[model samples]
Target: MLVTFLIITVTFAILTMLPLSRHEAWWIRGLDFPRLQLFLALLFTLALELSLLDLSSKQTWGLVAVALACLVYQAWWIVPYTRIFPREVKAANNSDSRGRIRIITANVLMTNRNAKVLFALIREFQPDILVTLESDLWWQSQLDILETDYPYTIKCPLDNLYGMHVYSRFPMMNSQIEYLVEPDKPSMHALVLLPSGHKVRVHFLHPAPPSPTENNESSERDAELVIIAKSVAETNVPVIVTGDLNDVAWSETTRLFRKISGLLDPRVGRGMFNTFHADYWFLRWPLDHLFHSKHFMLQSIKRLRSFGSDHYALFTELVLTADTNNEHNGLDADADDLAWAKRKTEDQNVDKSAVPQPEKHSVA
Candidate 1:
């Protein structure tokens, strides 16, 4: 048992350190399989400790050593809490004549049937643009009333976990349902016209996580996000990408995406929103995110009431500033991020020929 624990500890320790290495090739990140390593090591460690209560003192010490090592290894993931932006963007003494647009991103669980809660939240927030992840036909039906308030829409409702819906008050130009990595799983990409007639490209995505029920390997998911990073980099307009990215805010891939796309994370200096596993308060991270170009100033960000879903909705109000071109120090796009995006888009195109297609629907 001690030997087994040592092996697991060594494996997880090594995996945790992979992203720390400086590399230009994305496959190098394949070594940094965080979720998998964290899951398996903790699983076996707890199982042994729980079932083998009669172990001798020396064996218990060995378990303690292994457990301490695992905790220390995970400690690498904890970064010092710091503020990213101001406590609030709205000044108390100053009344600026700027328009505020509230954006909401919610992962309405496909299995959650409490549609009334979602309707109530929508009515309360009354966001200018709303994006729903993990939405299927049933979820789409529940949100049908939103169309009455928001005229524009981009719907791709699928039974697959990747189904997404986007509702906007302003007009959408050249919106399309795009499959970034696999068939059936689709993301929403659109050009939205703001109230001021300013155009911004918005992308909503919910890539599959590296779990038993989802894709076992995160390569495809990571690659697709890199593609999004590239897309945002190539766009001339201000952009906002929001969804349950299935990656942590501090993860290497997510960090790389932010750098490559030049998008600002609302949680950087703020507290961790940690909006997942609504049932289990302990096992949650900031899975839902809102990333935008520096041209926009954040007005507010909040985690909404927990709906009958696995995730808590994220609400962000932002004001688009004019001619804002501030550069952030200590930020640069890794060369590997560009390579990963190029390769992933190419690979996805090849797979698209063989990927499954969803049935046509009026709403989604």
Candidate 2:
């Protein structure tokens, strides 16, 4: 029992600290996804160790200390997502419908043919904008029915799992699909004109994950995110970035993205809103996300029911408000974060001129 507890403690402690290195390898980056699970495992180990405490052995005490330390480390990264932490985005104070925007983002597994389930949810929620990732030609054709309600659309249907589609009820100005990293991967950007005549720059991304089957390293994903973050930082308009980032909300790269973009996550003080691996209760994380500028306040946010895909749909209603006084101060990038972002973008040779211009398309 002592040997088994020692191995568990040492192994988890190493996993907890592996992501601190900047290396983008699949193994190291993958560790960022299961921080919650790690915390639970460490908690369980700590309880068992204490129940079998043998103070006479210094080694047992050492094991307990390491396990407790690892547990705290994991909590530091995840505690902000709980209600215990103060919210980064303030709640909407008024009931103005014109400024309200309801959005739903789902990563409908490419092979999952249960399109009706998603369609049903859209009908019930009646979101102003709907973004779907991992959608292909079949999913696109199935979704054409939405055009009756959503007159403006952006479509990039590919057999590849990275395919994306955005259906909107509002006018989408200067909309374009760009490949930020890998050529086969595509991300959509548009200026959505709301009913209140306010234009919100919306970006929908589905970056490739670092896995043996996908990219061998996270460089592509990290570089693409940094490129977008730099662009968001320079833009003056209200911005909303949403999709299956394929990265956790609490990961280092995500924290860097938040700092550089200065966008606020509604989930910060609300809840984790874990959306991926819908089938496995224990193996889920917040993969699908929506981060918006401080100009918007949260009305409501919830994880919708699973629809045959590995990920559940994420729904958020945000109201654009002028009251900035109550909003949480946005994250600021220090010298190191800015330097790291610069290095990643430089390494990828991301040229602004290379990005394609908007290709206008309207269903009506």
Candidate 3:
């Protein structure tokens, strides 16, 4: 039993190391929560190994239980197979003072020089608001044509891959560039004034991944997001927070954010529009997302083409409306989440070199 368990554990670890599980498994082709599945498999393997070492008589039974758990999760993607994907709400039926707002979010790879593809995507969608990540001066120049259409803009172009930008047809108010953690890493925060005189707070974030090359830990990233979530909960205006969150929709941190922010995910009853891993089709997950407050109803959501980047664009349409009832249906952020957020923010202040650096600018 121990040998078998060890073999399985080593195999799993090796698979993860080689990025073999970067995309969805063949059996779960359409499922977008590949990371979640992988983590569950690891947990089961750990439980089996611990049980085998701890219990002599029930070792076989423990192995059997672990094996069963792995098999179930291996086929867990099927749980939502029969579930219907969320469909777009018809524009004719849109009942809101502010018209439908089309938002196109793309994490244009900082090094991807295919400006043509990026421009082509923008032309095809013609979104009302364009949010791009990993943008530097070069990317900003490539997006010059967009300025005429979207007069209001907030730009933060950096080389660290944390730079973000927002371009909108409506005026941008209370706009500011924030460095959540790690100096020079910037996140765009702005308030958009709609044509109807309504204000919508927009938060565009691209935190470092929990990879060896990056933060090596996700505490800072998780905490920064939690703070944003809490702020969303406190704000009175309708808010639309979107970007390459560097986290999955089903993550514990994300769930807490949703709950604390009282935000709605368009992907909840909808399909998982996996946007990352643009180079690999099967290995994609919904890393890019648009979370909105209850003041808006989802109109549509679609995954756009590869914009010469590592991630595909997520195009979403949200109809802004007034939240008359003040009913928030998200999970509540526990004390732990608040504590984490506060600690992370404080940590950022301690590091002198962690000052929020200026973004590389380009006249787009």
Candidate 4:
């Protein structure tokens, strides 16, 4: 038992400590998802070793030291995401003038036909902006009632499971679909005109995940996200990028995205609102995300009840504040980060034609 525990400890620790570079392999990138799990495993292994190991053995002590080091390292990365750390996005003061927009983003698991439960949740939250991923024509028709309350809408229902739609109470300025890395997969890029007349750039995306059914690697997803990051940086405007990102809130790709786009995540220092794998309580992750420019302050974020889908709907309220831009904690992108992002976007296999132009849907 001691021997087996040591083997597992060493293997798990090595896997957890593996560096995630800009390289685009699925296994390497996938390693970023299980920090919390790795941390817990290390704790268990260390406890077993302490009780069963031969105290006078130098080898046993060495194994214990390595396990302790790995646990601390894993915790360093995962701790910021837990309540034990301070929040990255500051709380918002009641902005009665600028307006508070409540948006809900959910991936309805294209195969799951539970529109009734989804609609019921929507009616309960009454979100100002509704974005759904993995939605098909049937899901769109089921949500057609939203057109009445959510006046401005952008819909691209696809059977491929990458379909996306944005329904907003605020009018959308130049709402259009963009196929970043995949030709058939679409992402929404538009300006939402608030009741206060302020325009907020919104990017709703559902990039393909690294799975056997999709791409065997994370290359394409990384490219799609990098391109969006660069575009948002050029605008230097208030923006909200939300969707089932298909990546975790703590992945290196996500970290680079925040740095490049200057968006802030409210999840930092907050409890993990794990939204994926609604079926399994133990094996779950936070695949959906809501990232916004620093001009917005956190109001409240909720992981709503499951609606028979693999993902739980996320409803978040944010207030657009004028003076809070300089106050929030956001990643600062450097030249190295810019170069890395460029390489990810302009990779040899990337089809430039498939990348949608921002002005394609702009009305004269």
Task: State every prediction's TM-score relative to the real structure.
Answer: 0.75, 0.96, 0.76, 0.93
Per-residue lDDT over 1-364 for candidate 3, one digit per residue giving the tens place of the 0 to 100 score: 5777757865665444433232322222223247545656777676666665555547555555555555555434323322363322222245553656789999988899998987788788878899999888988887866898998898887887876778899877667787766567677777677677666778888877665566655656665676677666666677888998877676555776787678877676466778978998767677898988777776678898776899999998878754433244445666876665566556544332222221111111
Using TM-score, rank the candidates from best to worst: 2, 4, 3, 1
Better of 3 and 4 by TM-score: 4
User: For model 3, what is the error of residue 337's alpha carbon versus the real structure, in angstroms, after optimal superposition?
Assistant: 4.4
Among all windows of 10 consecutive residues in model 3, the one with the lowest summed lDDT is 355-364
Residue-level lDDT tens digits of model 1 in 333-358: 66776666556557545433222122
Write model 2 residue lDDT over 1-364, tens digit each, in one string.
8898988898998998899899989999999999999999899999999888686789899999999999999999999999999888888999799998999999999999999999999988889999999999999999999999998999999998988999999989888898987899999998888889888888899989999999899888898888888777776678899999999999999999999989999999999999989999999999998999888999999999989999999999999999984355667899999999888877778844444333223222
Quote the positional error of residue 294 for candidate 1 in Å. 0.9
- Model 3 per-residue lDDT at 333: 63
* Model 4 per-residue lDDT at 186: 89
lDDT of 4: 0.82
lDDT of each: 0.69, 0.90, 0.68, 0.82
Task: Please identify model 3 stretches exceeding 4 Å from their true place.
Answer: 1-6, 9-33, 36-64, 70-97, 322-328, 335-364
Clash list (residue pairs), candidate 2: none
> RMSD of candidate 2 to the true fold?
2.5
Angstrom error at residue 317, model 2: 0.6
Shift in Å, residue 12, candidate 2: 1.0
